[model samples]
Target: MLRYGLVVFIALLLSGCEMFGKKDIRLPIDVVSLQYDPYNYSMAELDRNATAACIAKGGTEAVAVDNEINTESVRWAYMNFNCYR
Candidate 1:
């Protein structure tokens, strides 16, 4: 019983380590934008386009911040970006 308890404790400890392993790094410049398409683009395409636009606007990294789908079938993708030095 003692060995089993030790193993469980170690497993939980290792899992906690993995959970806290990655940290989000924020940059000084944060840019947010939205791309919308009525009939020509998919969600993935919209994300790629928005990320490209963010990079073009001087962001080093771009991330999707939000998405909204309208009743008229319009798809909107929101992106957030952090500029690099």
Candidate 2:
């Protein structure tokens, strides 16, 4: 009896509930960390950090790289700054 019931269940599942064709099912997996590449577009903090670096080097903030810092460096810099504060 159990085997017959199991067979019916399997048949129904394979038949896509007798409605649509086989449905695509997505499964959730555990993620440890998700990191996305940072864009090169300049934001306020990028200006600040690079400016601070410039000032520490005895140069004006305007002399700082006028481009977006890579995302990984930005994250690391932000993480470091946050720890000190």
lDDT of 1 by residue, 1-85 (tens): 9999999999999999898895666664656555454456576765666567667777655665544446375354333434432
18-50 per-residue lDDT for model 2 (tens digits) = 678656553322111112235533446555664
Which of the numbered candidates is closest to the native, going by highest TM-score? Answer: 1
lDDT of candidates 1 onward, in order: 0.61, 0.43
Q: TM per model? A: 0.43, 0.28
Clashing pairs in 2: none
How many backbone clashes can be found in candidate 1?
0
Error of 1 at 10 (Å): 22
In candidate 2 the C-alpha lDDT for residue 31 amounts to 14
